[model samples]
Target: MSMFIRVKRKKTTYFLHCDPSETVLEIKQKLQALSENHVDDQRLILIANKLVLEDHKTLADQKVENDAIVAMTLKIRETGDWEEVVIDKPGEHPKPDTDAS
Candidate 1:
């Protein structure tokens, strides 16, 4: 079955459609096409468990499921260090009333 993941970086969220058999490297390549960041300079972390994803491992192997939230970090050119994950969540919306009195 096809699934999608929410790749969040800063305030931007990328919805990528993928299959469970797809490797992490493939996901990086897809992100590279969209974000223009080299695959080598990209790192993905599963936010739910703070697990760093391996490039050679398939999504199923890593237990990344449908609608999973992955944080993308880029390597700094000068420092050669990966940037900290920063996902800017949007402001919460007020809940609708449910009372029927």
Candidate 2:
């Protein structure tokens, strides 16, 4: 089965869906590769929307599964609280068709 990771960017959160078998590092690389704007490693910090994402830690270690929200913080929030977003939601997007490329 595959899993989904939620990466929180500046004022927004991004969703990355990948194989559950993949490691955290793999996911980080994938995020950078897929991002429209360049994403630096120094800016990448994993923070679960509900909990914490250990550094260099794989998703499997947390017993995470499909459609999970794996929050990734790019920059330190302004309120000094990285718990909640300062802006609005990134908005819902239609799922990419599996039949298409």
| Cα RMSD for candidates in order | 6.6, 9.6
Task: Report the poorest 10 consecutive residues by lDDT, candidate 2.
Answer: 37-46
Q: Which predicted model would earn the best lDDT?
A: 1
Question: Least lDDT summed over 10 consecutive residues: which range in candidate 1?
Answer: 88-97
Model 2 lDDT tens row, 1-101: 66676666555666787776666667767777766433333233334445555546667776666656555554434554443433245554566779954
lDDT of 1 by residue, 1-101 (tens): 99999999998899999999999999999999999999999999999999999999999999999999999999999999999999887764556889999
User: lDDT of each model, Cα atoms only?
Assistant: 0.96, 0.57
- lDDT measured at residue 37 in model 1 versus the true structure, 0 to 100: 94
TM-score of each: 0.88, 0.52
Clashing pairs in model 1?
A: none
lDDT, candidate 1, residue 8?
98
